[model samples]
Target: MAKKYVDINTLKYLLYDVYQLEEVLNQDRCEDHDISSMNLILDSVKDFSDRELYPYLKEMDEQPAHYKDGGVEVHKQVGVMMKQGGEMGFISGPFDYEEGGLQLPMMLYTASSFIQEAANNHLTGYIGLTLGAAELIINFGSQELKDIYVPKMLSGDWGGTMCLTEPQAGSSLSDITTKAIPQSDGSYKISGQKIFISGGDHQYADNIVHLVLARIEGAPAGTKGISLFVVPKKRPDEEGNLVSNDVTTVADFQKMGQRGYCTTHLGFGDAGECQGFLVGEANKGLKYMFLMMNGARIAVGRGGAAIATAAYHASLEYAKERPQGRKLASTGKKDPEEGQTFIINHPDVRRMLLFQKTVSEGSLGLVLLASKYYDLKHTLTDEKEKEKYGLLLELIIPMVKTYPSEMGAQSVSNGLQVLGGYGFCTDFILQQYHRDIRIFSIYEGTTGIQSQDLLGRKLLLENGKALQLLTEEIKQTINSALKYDDLKKYAGKLGDKLQEASKVIQHLIGFAKKGDYERFLSDATPFMEYLSTITLSWIWLEMAVNAKNALVTGKKTYSEEFYESKIHAMKFYFKYELPKTNGLAEVLLNEEVLTIAGEKEVFN
Candidate 1:
């Protein structure tokens, strides 16, 4: 078992030092929480993860979940995870205390989630999906619906999922053909097929509740007519007896990685007996589902970052323990008297490790920033304050989802490279991590989807007010960076990049203004890459400034080495990662527009 996957210190540092999560806790919505209580929550989660999760990661992966006898079977520990997680309020942490929750901040829940995700990525989703589904119920479900489903779902006796994608429609939700017919008793008969439903069917839970999206009969076409339904594998009869709901587990998807997570093909109302209860009102299903999207996307990114963290640590451990080469002298001659040096001592290995460090830890910072924004947006009383944080959150949601996913893949790949041949073999964890992380970019939304949302929608959010707020925020960080002599040059470099960003955005917006959306959105993925790179640079700089302040202020909360490592990583990110934005901007600015459909086809 890989013992060290995530660094808890990094999570705390981002939450307390860089972001000052206490600011949110002091707000009216979360005033009950404090730093000490939150720390204990994190500490307890980490301890639970160490005992129940970390040890079985490999075992779960080796014994992949399988489908047989009308249900999907997974590693038995999945039950333990859901049950214990609920008992400890991990699922209900972010909900209101009146709703039987601990009412913890989302960032703290995010921190707890990262620890478990790093410990066992495949198994953690069962709990995550349950949390997402349960939250949706708490927010939108009718009182009776809540009375029947909320308690069991949150208690871990019943798992929950958002059934969105279908085999025919995939990411295109408008094309889904699922149908829900209204019945006399305020229930609907749902008939549809949903594919790639994670935690779709599991034997451990007594029942699974699916928040399914289906169109009511005689409603308008496309997403406008869609409605959200609370569909369960087993429903209570008029006498309150549990009976099968005819929600069939069609098959299990055997994937190259994350094998323990049971992704299934589902057939609803196969025998025309599936009953579903409406959530909120009809035709607002898409909106209700979208309300949960930002949080879900952030969780997906966190999963990617956590996997990369685990993979990096696994590779780092291998590099430190498996020494094979001798160190060369300044004259480029091997020292015969000096024995073989650990690969970690080699500059190239260290470079790869540092790259992983910058990507994983920095990605963590970005996600927490998004979550903090979420906290403030919902918690703040002033309308202007809420609007500001909400827009900022809107502007960065795409990057928050894409950067960790798209870059975390590269980070995990580097981790594999660090392990050399062992990285490719099943004997090491990197190979599985390499496979596990490939799906993140595709999850929640693909990178292309995120990029388009960024360029077409998010960039223009609230008539560009969001981007302006982002610029102002970045400028604040730059101003802080300017205070230190060592960081002044990097700060200036960032200022130039911000100007360049303005120029590039103007150049693209000009295309959009002229009704050339084809060209405007052609290089969106590259723009996403560019903007995500710049965003991470901003975060690293902020972290560096905080670390420097700690050291200079004589606040020895962490050791000098701890603070210095972030400083070094910040510098490393600026040198290595930020420069790529220039090339991406070049691609975004070029008017040639090769990728858009042209007069003639280029590919065979």
Candidate 2:
């Protein structure tokens, strides 16, 4: 059978060897789950996605959600998929058992989510919003608030959205003009227009819960004045029944991709005062939102990675089946006598396949590793270990979010190139994959935003503690590799790259501390790229080490071809991929490459 998604062998290697997800199941915090249980859950999720969700993918994108007669209408097929997903308890996987969740570890949950996302990206948005909402309420909302809303969201009886953007306040939250008037009761009346609110107003659920950021009356100005509110489409009565809350939809944005989800323009308190309850403390909206944003950001990155994996698989399948040309080395004229061979025989096609393999599998390996850190942060009982993993997560979050996103989009575009004209046409799936993956860099946060966050906040503000933790972890991995004969050479090269990356980061830190903001910001993207490349290289090396152990131990059954392919992927990344760091480091050290001083006309 043709492979429609990520290769199963690659998935097995990633889950067992690289991530060691089974080890996580044994952790005390994950006592609720064992490997068997987790595998069962994953199997169910994979089946649902393959059978129910994958079939509707093209139809959702082609038909899209449309706004008419005052309500946005999502495709009925998407609604069915979401309802089935909810029935399977996927939307609530990370929630507490008391709140209708499966009480699964975040690692297992995120791993399952990646399969669903790869199978169908458009429909995953609904689940994403639900998870985001559940997280926010569980973290900061009042007990009453959690009691009232958490279960409904988890069950998909209701949908949720984060309403932070306004017409004037795109990236600058401090400039928002949304007003919140304090009422005689403790609640406030929220009045404002919010744009780009994903899943803001959809018919998939009975009601929509908007986690809005607005300024309360008499509150201080700037971001400090902003507060988060749980504003629902309808107010629940004494009987806990929902009624119109006066929040109305003004319009829905017509977007370029991921059109299955509703992106609405919302007007709060238009018909009557929209009642809202505060979440957490006043003036700390951004901090609270960051909790949700951080999770969502990583999720978006994984989504991008998943799409790239799908596109690569699709292109590979097409290349293997479609007969096109002959081997370049063959001088035999017109193989018409022998019949045309498959495109896979062409060296150029092989090159494209290798490119897609490295980026897609490399991204999958990297993101899953990041999710493992998430599991450690939550599941580790040792305070020191938790803090250590937390620091590492902070340092790598930008890369995990930006690197896969940026590279995933590149991989999908290149996958299209491998297909030639068919890739450009709507008849093939690659065109839609290209359009879908393009949104990754923009959502969660822009690539530039992630770059600035890495250099400005993660690197500089922490005084290099996070980077130090990461270096120690990589060094430990390298030290372990010394015991393995097959991995020693690869580990040695990675060690050298680690040293180079660290020196560059240290120099940039010193430069920034000396008030060289221009020099510091100028090298930000290169620094980010260098760090990301090195991190992924380190992960690929770790996988290589594990593959060697698998071959030597003979503890499991696998073909020689599988291990050989794994080695090839590792070697390909190091040989063809790691050299980019040289250019990146050069860009950082030399001030000439800084584009800030370039003319505006040059930009044009």
Candidate 3:
């Protein structure tokens, strides 16, 4: 199989034609960039991935990251990606010029990241966590703290990780017991154990900085008491010398997949000497950490998208070349005497390939759409436009973070199936793709957590105005798609989904209105899948209409095959994938209360 991890043409189409990257580039924040400049960076990153990422993926996975000599030893490529990524501005692309960044649009940076992830997801985490942690410090840390931490992180001389999960708390962050005792010098003595910390402790960088969530001494209970801290593995001394802050790598967690990305159990203040500096105001830590979590959520979705894409191309290449069986005729007759035919000639194989394409491409589009909203939320000049974009971003975050993750995982599984038994074998990368993507749905937030968040909070955000804004946007797409005769049915189908979603939401809201919040959110997961299906349908329809218009106007950026392919995938999604909502909605509207804990024990 070819080393075709990502389709640059498809990425370009989504960014340039579908999402309109120029609209973002025209903004004051990105005025210095255009498509040509963006393409140059994309090409560079692709080349770098080819050289530094793809070939080494299996080797790293086989070797894996392990604890050695009190530090985690990752593949040497980890160091290469960090230094080269920092030199190429991958770590600081979206920061301002003065912040030692390229000052580029987030959309472009994310697109490049998709390529890197598809090539080697395990390696991508090293730099991604650094960038996210540094961004938190830049946004919320004091000037002195920023001066101390952000530059080194961005330069790849240091690494960063967010310490949130504990052995007992799991996802219930409110129950975290990490403590921060204030000192006379304004620094705090931090003590806690954070498990499942990715890129937590590695020998690839000189030092590691942790953005920790801890509670101050004598503060309120629960989330209200939490505060953010910049706790480094080695806090700097008065003469800028690096010394131990008593942060210890207690153990590295071995995983079933993403073998090269180290997840460690960290113990802070074992010697009662862990120094932590406060970030922003006290008790607003959750709020600030959420800012990075949202970004990490989208990144996780992109990880899913990238893995699915790589698997699709791998399976596709195999299908086109690997000959095994003969295809049946239109009359449903097969001749055993005939020579073997390529799997691509078989309808079933084509079906599997199309499913992979549909989920992978659509996932990329959904994530890019969210990134566009993010760029607009920050860059737009008008307050109203910024606010509108912000609301839209908030509303679709659950879907943007989840559809690609959950659906993309299923898509990769199907890709594995396409290769028959070889997909699960080490001869192919499909098995690794499957393992690497399984974590996204569980990372940042689980699918259930994201679902409950969407149906419970975002729908009611801003007095329900956030959902209203999304409705208007979807309707606008439907209205534009109505111009083409071929798209009318899809347009109508999408409009019906909107109505179905509205009805389902209203029915769920009734339970909320009656003060039965448990019943209101009982079916939140199904409702989330329902809403995500509708959103993906809307996304596909919008892209198909763009392709149709391009073909009609003869203003093709890609080949006619590409445009026609979009139309075919749109039809496939409508015919095969969209109807899934009917079953999900059925589950949502049945009013069955079997899920919530009841007065009597149900399960045996």
Candidate 4:
């Protein structure tokens, strides 16, 4: 069979069946929309992505934004896509209908966004930033602020960026030195330099709204003194028309990948002073910024997963079409009659494909599940249910953000490997996919940061309650799978893995309190990886059970080949992917190997 982009039917199955999005739509929060309507929106976006976005993907990577004279210029193609995306209403899907948004469920919105990301990742960054900014305004800004900003942003007349990182303070928000001084008006004058700001400066939109984090004058040091401000490139008047603002561009960064979106160094107060309004309360900037960061983190994770999925799909197509050496068992050497078989016939190629499939699909399923939880927390009528969903989301955020990021990169790398020498060349999209996906594990919070957040804050502060809740959910999933014969053995295996993972989590918690904090922290990344493996395994098993039920009941029509492929992916995950947890668990239990006291100069 000819290789193609992502299998649309498979995507539909994963979204509607595996994630139970239809059931989520029936919830009170989404009572206004039905599955058909949601599907229509998604189908349109998918079609647009396939036709309009995918073709420019390679060109955008090759012709990244260039810095000149005091501003950055992105590929002209990006502007076209941005305008099309804006016109399609994708930039405002989750906002209120009165604000020109479709008011779609978060799950559906995320699913649609995933298609765009898969088609062209760098182009998608613009939309991600815009959505993040709009969300920050909706959550924290005043009614007056919303009146001035939300409609313009929703209409795609403007774009947004998060300005938090500095040359000195990269990840340590507390160390940031950006200054915000109060003016006669309610607004503040923000003066600072922010670096690595994505979508920071672009011609695609009329103006750029920067959600900046800066400290107030004479305020106590660290994050407590920091406040979030709405700093626009051109300050809007009472009627929201553009007015002069003292925002300047210091430089634009040339990155390793995702070049279509401008990463820039922005200087405020360079010309004079940038007028800004406080978001939320003073000295609580980190709190408000976290709301946006958390949302962006999930978005980055989903972007990583989408890139991996696209690469896998592309590689799968390439493997099936590209003829190579015959199967290993074919001993006849020089038989021109036999000719060359497709690379898919090779075991190594199959291994790479399976690895990509397991990671990409599993990560996609996990992210969609998390997005559904976001919807449930906001939409569910039952207070306790909402609380449960919220806690679960909190516990899973680190995993959802980090796991897909770490594994998604690995998946894309394997995808490149599937293409042999072609994968290494710039001519193929796999190379660009690898470059684009590599940033996932680093941005949004490095894997290390997420690990510390997971163990230090999420697990420890809650007295392990969040983790326990997640364990129970996995247990319930396994319990439900017991009735299905196809999944019984896999469920038992998953149960054992979960039990082992649970033990590791408990042991790590006890170790942390024993004053061996360094030793315990040393294993945080591995522990996170272990937890992610088990969690994704449980999710894949749940999906497998659903697939099996569908197959048995004949409720949904599927080709024998497709059903077999689904079963193969599930088995590949369990047989090949799940067993790695034991090794990760071993490392968690014995942290001594990593805690070896060595001087930094020793390696040098």
Candidate 5:
């Protein structure tokens, strides 16, 4: 089978036609960019990823980062690739030109990242965190801090990590015990341990910058007292020479996948010498970190979509090339000479492939849509427009983060199944893709955490205005799609889903109003699952309508099969995936809370 990254045609259609990215580019913030330049940037990244990253993906996975001689040793290729990415300016693709960036629109950057991540996620992740780290400094750091740290990080001369997870504290960051003491020179001495810090300790860069959250002495307890700090692995001395800052690597974690990058247990101020500079205000660390977290969460979603896309294409290639059992339609035939039929001709294999297609592409569209909202939220001058887009982004962030992650895992599994026994073997990358994407749902925030955010907070924020705004957006899509003969059915189905979801949410709100908050959120996970399905349904309908319009109006530049495939996948999603919401809604509407409400003795 041929090696693949992603379907370029579908991406072009989504960006240029469905999403109308050209319109976005015309906006003041993105007016400087156009399709041609964005395409060139994307092509460059793809070419580099194909040549440098894809070939070394297996090597990186096989050669996991190791703890040797008091330092982490990753595949040497990782350093080379990081430098390659840095030189290509991908590390600062969305930043301003003055910052040595291309200032590409986020939509274009998301698409570019999709291709690169599809080619090799483990390697791409090394720089992904660096971009986020740099963005934090740009958004909230002092001018000096930004001037010093952001440039090197953007250049990939220095690596970056978000240090939040500790030995005792995982997702509940309020429990973090990392301490930062004020020093005489306007710096703080950071002392604590952080675990699962990816790319934490490596020789890929000249230095590593850690965006750590620590508490100052005499501060209040919990997350309210946490402060953000920029702690570098090596700090400059009085002569401006980089020296060891007392940051130590206690250990490296061995994971099931993404072995190319290092996840380290780091100890700060073991020698009582580690120093850090505060970012933004003290005790506002969580607030500042969340700025990075939201973007990282969406990036995780894109990662999930990218890996799933690679799996789908690989399996699709395998199915077409690898001859297997006869199609079920040929059951009564006795043509022995005909031999085995291609597995793609079989309905079951097609089902699996379509599922992968709908999940991967639909999730990709959802993420890009959220990114558009993010752009408008930041760049729009009108306060009302910014506020509207802000609420829209807040509501969809969890879905855009978790839906692709959880569903992409399932899609990859289906892709693996499509390849039969060969997928489990090392001859193919399916198993690796499967392994790497498992961390998508687990990291960023678990599906459970996202579900709670979606239900407990997003739904109730501003007295339910966020949810109303989201529904209105969905309604607009429905209204636009309702007139299309080919899309009306899916549009109507999506409308029903919105109504059903609204009712379930209202029912949950009733419990909350009565102060039964725990019970109100008891089935939040399932509710999130249902909402994700509806959101994707809306996306599929929107895409189908766009495809239908292109084909009917002769506006499509691709072959007929290209447009048909979009509609086919949309139908597959509506017929097979969207209906699952009914059962989820049923569970949400029911009052029986067996998991949390039942007696503990019942389990035994």
Candidate 6:
């Protein structure tokens, strides 16, 4: 078992020093909770993660949830963990006290989630989806609908799923064919099949609630006419009895990793008796679903970073303990007096380790920034303040989802590489982590989907205000770093990248304006890569400034090694990763249409 999931010093540095989460806790929306209480909660969660979750991660991957009889049967440890999460109120930590929650700030809540996800993502998925479902009802469901659902779901007596994907549609949600027809009792009969539904049909809960998206009869086609429904595996009768609701589990997906979590294919109204209650109104389901989807997207980002961070630490420990070949200088020397050196001393191994470190730590920082923006958007009373944060959040969510996922996949792969042959074996945890994080870029929203959203909608919408907000933040970071001589060079480099990014975006916007969208969006994936690289550069610069301040002022909050390590990591990113944006931006500006339809005619 991995004794540590994440570096405690890094977590504390980012939470208290860089983000100032304590101030966020003191805000009007979350004033009831203070830093000391939040720290205690965090300490407890880390203990749970270390003792309960990490030990079972390997077992969960080896023995996944299986389909039997009529439902999916998961590992017994899953049940125990779910119950503990509920009883401790971790599932509802971000909600209000009136809603039976601890009402911690989103930053603190997210930090706690990061710890658990790093330990075991499969176990965390159930509670994450349940909280997301209950929050959906709290925001858009009617009072009666809330009465019928929220409590049991939050208490972990029932599991919840967002039933969005269909066999034929996949990421194209508008093509979903699920049907919800109205009945005499104001409920609708939901009939459809949903696939890849996580926590869809687990035995840990007494019943499962599926937030199904289906079209009402006589409604328009496409997403404009779809409505959301709350359909459960079992229904309540007038006598307050539990009865099967004709919701059937078709099969359980045998996944590569995160195997202990149930991913199911479901059939609704197979016997024509699956009744569901409407969430809001007809034709408005897609909008309401976005509330849950947006939150899930950010969670997916956090999971990617969390898992990769775990892999990095594991690899670091292995490198320190497993002594290997001699240093390059002594390779030819065959004297018995000299002994083998540790792998950490090798330049190439050190390079891979540094890459993993930068991606994991930098991605975590980016996600927390997004979480803070989300809190401000939802809680601030000032319209302008809300609007600023809202636009900023809207703009970066794609990068928030895509960058960590894509980069974390690479980061974990690098972690495995650092272990060499041992990484390929089942005995080491890196193999499983590599498999687990692979799904991050593919789920919630695929990288392709996120790329399109970045170039097509987020960049183009509101007449470029979203991009403007992003650049303004980057520029502000640059200004702060200017005062420090050690960081000014890297800050200037980031400024140049920002200017280059702006130029490419302006050119692409012109193509869209002139009805050349084919060329405008052809290279969207590369554009996403460019934006993500620049965004992380900004974050690294901010962190570097803070690290330097601590060192120069002789602050003893952390050891000198800690601050020096931070500075070195920042330098590594600028030296190696930041340069990636230049090549990607060049491809975007050159306007080469190499991958368009006509260019592939010869192959066919």
Q: What is the C-alpha RMSD of each candidate to the true structure, in Å?
A: 1.0, 2.1, 1.0, 2.1, 1.5, 1.5
Q: What is the C-alpha lDDT profile of model 3 across 1-604, one tens digit per residue?
A: 3558899999999999999999999998888888899999999999999999998988988999998888898999999988988888889888998878888887998899999999989999999999999999999999999999999999999999999999999999999999999999999999999999999988889999999999999889999999999999999999999999999999998998999999999999999999999999999999999987668888988999999999899999989889997878767898899899999988888999999999999999999999999999999989999999999999999998899899999999999999999998987888988898899999888999999999999989999999999999889999989999989999999999888888888999999999999999988888888999889998999899899999999999899999999999999999999999999888888966888887999889
Better of 3 and 4 by lDDT: 3
Best by lDDT: 3
Q: For each candidate, give its TM-score against the true structure.
A: 0.99, 0.96, 0.99, 0.96, 0.97, 0.98
Write one digit per residue (lDDT tens) for candidate 1, span 1-604: 4669888888899999999999989998788788999988889988998999988888888999999998899999999988998899878788888777877888888889999999999888998898889888889998888889888888888999999999889999988899999999889999999999999998889989999999999888999998999999999888988899989999999998899999999999999999999999899899999999999999998898899889888888888898888988989999888889999999999999999999999899999999999999988999999999999999999999999999999999999999899888889889889999999999888999999999999999888999999999999999999999999988998999999999999999998999989888888899999999999999999999999899899896788999999999999999889999888888878878677777899999
Candidate 4, residues 1-604, lDDT tens digits: the string is 1135566777777778877788788876567898889878988988898788888888888788988887889887667766887788888888777666777887888888888888888888887788788889888999988888877777677888888899998999999998989998888988889999988887778898999999999988988898999999998676957886888888888888897878899999886668888998999988887865656777878998899889998899899889987665456454666679999988889999999998988888888888888888888889989888888888889999998889998998998899989999987889888888888888878899999888888876467677778889998889878888777888899889877876887787786779877766777888888889888888888877777777778886667667667767888999988899888877788746534476554453
Scored by CA lDDT, what does every candidate get? Answer: 0.91, 0.82, 0.92, 0.83, 0.87, 0.88
Off by over 4 Å in 2: 1-3, 330-338, 484-486, 597-604
Winner on lDDT between 1 and 2 is: 1
Pairs that collide in candidate 4 are: 3-317
Per-residue accuracy of model 6 over 1-604 as CA lDDT, tens digit each: 4556698788878888888887677678887778788789889999988888888899999988999997899988778777888988878788887776777777888889999999998899999988988888888899987777888887888878889999999988889999988999899988999999999987789888888899998889999988999998998888967899989999999998889888999999999999998998889999999966667888999999999999999999988888988775546654556699899988899999999999999999988888888888877888998999889988999999998899999999999999999999999999999999999999888898899899999987698888888888889989989989888898899989888887988888888999998888888999999889989988888888889999888875899999888889999999999998878878988955687787348573
- Name the lDDT value of residue 265 in candidate 6: 97
Give the per-residue Cα lDDT of candidate 3 at 169. 99
Residue 524 in model 3: lDDT: 85
Q: Any runs in candidate 5 off by more than 4 Å, and if so which?
A: 328-334, 597-599
Question: lDDT of candidate 4 vs native?
Answer: 0.83
For model 6, name the residue pairs that clash: none
Model 1, residue 315: C-alpha shift (Å): 1.7
lDDT of 2 by residue, 1-604 (tens): 1258866567767876678887777787677787788778878888888887777778888888888888898988657755777778878887767767777876777778888888889888887887797788889999999989887888778888888899998988999988888788789898888998888887778888889999999989898899999999987999988989888888888777787877899999986568998998888888899976657877988898899999998999999889886554357565655667899887778878887888888888877777788888878889998888778888888988887788888888888998899999888889998998888888877888899899889875467788888888888888867788877887899989988876787778776779987777776777788888888888877777777777778854468678777778888888878889998888777746537675545654
lDDT over C-alpha atoms for residue 583 of model 4: 85
Clashes of each: 0, 0, 0, 1, 0, 0
- In model 2, the Cα lDDT at residue 493 comes to 90
Return model 1's CA RMSD, one decimal.
Answer: 1.0
The better-scoring model by TM-score among 1 and 2 is 1
